[model samples]
Target: MELDGNALGGDLSSVFAADVTGAVFVCAGCQHSGVVASLRVWVPAPGLVGRCPNCTDVVLRLVRTPTRAFLTLTGASRLELPLD
Candidate 1:
């Protein structure tokens, strides 16, 4: 079964100051751009992973602990977020 980016809502909201599901993510590997909500997500991984829909490249990674959360966007060339 496949899951969409919305599955990361609780996890993402914990790290970002704003709702980032609507943010645009540009894939570094294929230069494909899409909304965060549109990315494919894998929650069963060691952590949460969001991948580009067009190229199947990882776009974002999130790992959370009891007191800390780590987010990496190495696969994303750019992330455009809404101002409001």
Candidate 2:
């Protein structure tokens, strides 16, 4: 199913040490840039797959295991974290 990126807020914050919903991501595939919150997230997969809103390219994937959470940035070329 399709969900907003905010669905992974707690998981993301724990991994980033800050809220990542406001962070801007530049997709390498189509060069689309937007906040993570605006990305489309697929939750049915084994991991949370976040895609670029404009290009629909997979930008990130977040998988949480019992011991650690693995985050893979697939097509995101640049990430601009918010300045508090």
In TM-score terms, which candidate is top?
A: 1
- lDDT, residue 8, model 1: 77
lDDT of 1 by residue, 1-84 (tens): 579988878899998898899889889999998889999987578888998999898899999999999999999999998997
- Taking the candidates one at a time, how many backbone clashes does each contain? 0, 0
Pairs with steric clashes in candidate 2: none
Q: What is the Cα-based TM-score of model 2?
A: 0.93
What C-alpha lDDT values do all the predictions have? Answer: 0.90, 0.89
TM-score of 1: 0.94
Cα deviation of 22 in candidate 2 (Å)? Answer: 0.2
Error of 2 at 66 (Å): 0.6
